[model samples]
Target: MIEANTPLLRLLRTYWPLVMLSLGLLIIVAIVDSSGDVILAQTLIEGLVRIVIVAALYLFIGNSGIISFGHIGFVMIGAYATAWQTCCPYTREMFMPGLPVYLLNNSHHFVLAIFLGGLLAAVVALISGYAIMRLSGIAASIGTFALMMVFYSIYLRWSTWTSGASSVIGLPTTTTPWVGYAYAVVAIVGAFLYSRSKWGLALRSSRDDEVAAKAAGVNVFGQRLLAFVVSAFFCGMAGGLFGHFLGMLTVDSFGLGMTFITLSMLVLGGMQSLTGAVVGVVVLSFLIDILRRLENGMVSGLNLPTSSAEVFVGIVIILILMFRQSGITGNQEVYWPFKGDVSASSAMKRQS
Candidate 1:
C-alpha cells in the first residue's frame, strides 16, 4: 500500500515512464519536422492539439465513465474568446463590432488570450455542470449533447459577436509544432498527476460502482464536476491553439463533425488511460494524414475522392470496436518494467 505520507518525489518517480514516453514521441516528430516538411509539421501540430483535447477528455470521461459530447462546445468558446482578445483592433471592429470597449480597444498577447480562453470555458463548464452532473447514464449524455446544441445555436445566431454561421477570419497563425509540443507536454503532466490523485481515484471508484462509492462517502457529483471543469479548461486551451493554427474559426469547425472525430480518437485509444489518449491521437492523426495524401495522389498514381479518408476512418473505427471494445490500452497505463511487482502487489491488495 502507498503510505499516506509518501513523498512527492516518489509519486513523481512512479509516473516518469509515462512522461518520458510522451516526450519521446514528440521529440521524434520534432526531428522529422526539422527537415522542413511543412505538411508534416502541420500534421504534427494537429496531432499535438488532438492529444491535448483527448487528454482532457480522458480526465473526465475515463475516470467518471461518462461520455460527454458537449466538450467541443467548450472548444468553440475558447477559440472565439482567444480570437476576440488577439485579433487586431481593425479586424475586431470590422467583424465583431458589438463588442464592449475593453475587448474592442485592446489586443492582448497570445499567451494571455489563450489563458483567458481556457478560463472562460472552465467557468462555463462549472455553471453547466451544476445541473448536468446531477444526471447519470444516458440522461447525462443527452444533457451534454443538448448543451452542445445550445452553444452551436447561440454561436450560429449571434451575428454581431460571432459573425453567425460565417467563418471568423484574421486570427493569428501562431501555433507551431514546438508550441504545440510544449502544451502537449503540460497537458500530459497535468492529466497524469490528476489521474493518480485522490479525487481521480474516488471518481473512478464511483464510476465502477456508484452505490459502493456513495456508501464509502465519496461525493460523486462533486468529483464529477471537478473533473468536468478541469477537462474543459485544457480542451478550451486546445481550441485556442487550433484556432491560431488554422487562422480561422467557424461553427462547423466545432460542431458535430469535430465532436465525432475527437470522441472517436479517444475511444480508439482506450478512453480509460492517459497513455491511450496520446497514442490514439498520434496513430489516428497520422493514419488520416496518410490516407488524405493518398487520396490527393501524393504517393500512388491513383487519385481517390476526397471522402475516401473519412470512409477509411469509419471502417477502421468499426473494426476496432468490434474486436477491442475496451480500446487499444484497455484501462492500463504504459508499461513500466521496474514497477511490475508494485502493480501486481496493488492488484492483489485490491482483490483481497
Candidate 2:
C-alpha cells in the first residue's frame, strides 16, 4: 500500500502520462492562439474536438478490440438533441413543428443543451447496445453500421425533428478553442481512468480471449455495453461541440464521411492505446490542414485538386496499414522519461 507521505515526485510520476497529454494540449492551444490565424485556430479547434471523439472511440475499441462503425450515429443524435433545445425558439417552432410545446416555445442554455444531448445519446446507446453487444466479431460491426444507417434514414425522413436534410442554423457560437481544449483534456483523463479500471481490464481480457475471460468470471457483454454507453456519451458531447462551433448542422455531415474519417484516425493512431487516439488526431489533422491549404491555393506556388486532401489521407492510411500495422505509437503509450518499475507503479495506481 502507498503511504500518505509519498513524495510529490512519486505522485507526479504515477500520473505523468495524463500530465504529459494535458500539458501538450495546453502548449498546442498557446501556439494556435498566438498565431492569430483564424483558419489555423479553427483547424486546431476542430482537431481538439476530434480528440474528444477519437478518445471516446478508444475507450471501447481499444479495450474491447471491436471496431465500431456506428458511433457517428450517436454523434448525430447529440447534434440534433442540442439543436432541438438551443436553436432559436422561433426557428424550432417553424421548422420542427413536431416538437412538444416546451421545446418549441423555449430555448435552453448551450451548456445544458450539450449535456442533455450527451445524456440522450447515452440513453440511446444503453438501449441499442443491449442488443448490439450480444453479437461478436464481424456481425457486431455490421450491426453498428446498420445502426448508423438507421439514424441517417430516420433523421433524413423525419423533417419535423431534423429539418429534413436542410441545415439547422442558429446554434450559439460558443465552442471556442479553450472550450474544445477543456473537453479534450476531460476526455483524455476519463479515458485513462477507464483504461485503468477493472471494467476496462476485463473488456480487454475478453478482447484477447473471450473463453479465457469468461472462465475467469468476466461478464463480457456487460462490460462491453458499459464501454459502449460511456463511449457514446463522449462522442455525443463531441457532436454538441461540433454543432456549436460550426453554428449549424446537417444530417449529411454525420454520415459515412465522418464515420470513415474518424475510424481512420483511430486506426492510424494505433487504436490500441490512449496515446494513439490523441496522436492520431493531431498527426492527421495537421496533415489534412496542410493538404487543404495546398488544395485551396492558400499557399502560393502549389495548387491541387479539390478532393486531393481526401486522396492523400487515403494513401497515407494505406501506407500505414501496409508498413506499420500497429500505427506510429506501436500500440503503446508515452511512458515516463525516467524508467522505473512500471508494473509496480501500475499496480499501485490500480490499488488506489
Candidate 3:
C-alpha cells in the first residue's frame, strides 16, 4: 500500500525512454548471444547489485539527512567474507586455510557464502551505527570514513588472513542478470515501503527538520541508526552479489572511487527521491559504456589514448552538481501535475 509519484520509476515505464522495454530486450539479447555471453551477463548482474546499493543509499540518506562515504567499506567487508568462504585453502594455503570449522567446508557453496557476507555487513553496520550516529554532520562522515580506512588497512596488511594484495581466487560466480534485476525490484520495493511507512516518515521528519521531528516524538538518533542499519544490510547483500559475479575481488575495488561514483549517482538522480538513484545508476552506467566505447576507439584505431573513462564521469558529476543543486527531482513528485489526486492522496496519507 505504499505510494509516491516516483518520477523516474514511473517515467521508466513509459515508451519513450524504452526502459519499459529494456528487460525484454536484454532477455532477447542474452538468448541470442551464445559465445562468451557470460561476460555480458556478468556485467548486467553487477549493475543489478549497483542498483540495489544505490537504492538503499538513497533510502537512508533521504530519510536521515546524513551523508555517507563509508558504505563501500560494507562492500569490502562483504567481499572478504564471501572470499574467505571460497578461499580454497589448498590452492592458496598461505592465506586463509579455510572457513571456520563450523561452516561448510566445500567453499563453493554460493548461496551460503553470499548470505554470510551480507549478514556480516549488517552486523558491522549495527555495531558501527551506535558509535557513528551519536555525532552530527561532518563528524559522522569523517568517523565512518575512518572506519573504512581502518578496514582497508586491515584487509591490505593482514596478508595471512586476506592474502594482502593478491587477488582472492577460487570463487564460484552464481550471479546472473536475472538475479541482478530481481534484486533491483526487491530493493526498489523495499525503499518504497520504507518511504511510506511510519518509521520512514519519522526519519523523513528528522531529515527535514531535526528539532521539529524531535518535538513530534521522533528520536533523531534512533531514526538515523535504524536507517544506517537497514542501508548497510542491503549494501552488504549487493557487495556479496558483486563478489560472486566477478569471481575475483580486492579491497581497492570498493574504495573511495566507488563511494564517489555512487554519491555522484545519488546527487545526479536526486537525493530526496529513490527514483533519482535509479536514474543516476542507469544513466551513469550507460555513460560509462559510451565512454568505454569511445576510449576503445581512441586507443585502438584513432591513435590518441586516454587515462581513464572515469575522468569523463567526473566531469558529468561536476556539471550536474553545478547546474542542478537539488538534482532532477528537486524534492517534488513525478505526478505533482495531478494536483487533485495528489492532494487527496496527501490528505488521506496525513490522516492515516
- Judged by lDDT, which candidate is best? 2
Instruction: Report residue 176 deviation for candidate 1 (angstroms).
Output: 0.8
For 63-137, candidate 1 gives per-residue lDDT tens digits of 999899999999999988998998756788878887888999998899889989999999999999999998887
Ranking by lDDT: 2, 1, 3
Higher-TM-score candidate of 2 and 3 = 2
* TM-score for each candidate, following the candidate numbering: 0.93, 0.94, 0.82
Which candidate gets the maximum TM-score versus the true structure? 2
| Residues forming the 10-long window of minimal summed lDDT in candidate 2 | 1-10
Predictions in order: lDDT: 0.86, 0.89, 0.72
Query: Candidate 2 lDDT, tens digit per residue, 1-352?
Result: 3332358767776677799889998999999999999999999999998999999999999999889999999998998998888886667777788898888888889888988998999999999999999998889999999999998999999988889888888888889999999999999999999998999999999999988999999999999999999999999989999998999899999998888888889889998989899999999999999888899998888888898988888898899999998888888777666645455545668799
Candidate 1, after superposition: displacement of residue 232 in Å? 0.6
Candidate 3's error at 181, in angstroms? 1.4
Error at 323, model 1, angstroms: 1.1
Question: Candidates sorted by TM-score, descending order?
Answer: 2, 1, 3
> Which regions of candidate 3 fall more than 4 Å away from where they truly are?
1-42, 87-94, 103-108, 298-304, 331-340, 343-352
Candidate 1: TM-score?
0.93
Q: Candidate 2 has what TM-score?
A: 0.94
Colliding pairs, model 1: none
lDDT of 3: 0.72
In candidate 2, the residue pairs with backbone N, CA or C atoms under 3 Å apart (3 or more residues apart, or in different chains) clash, namely: none
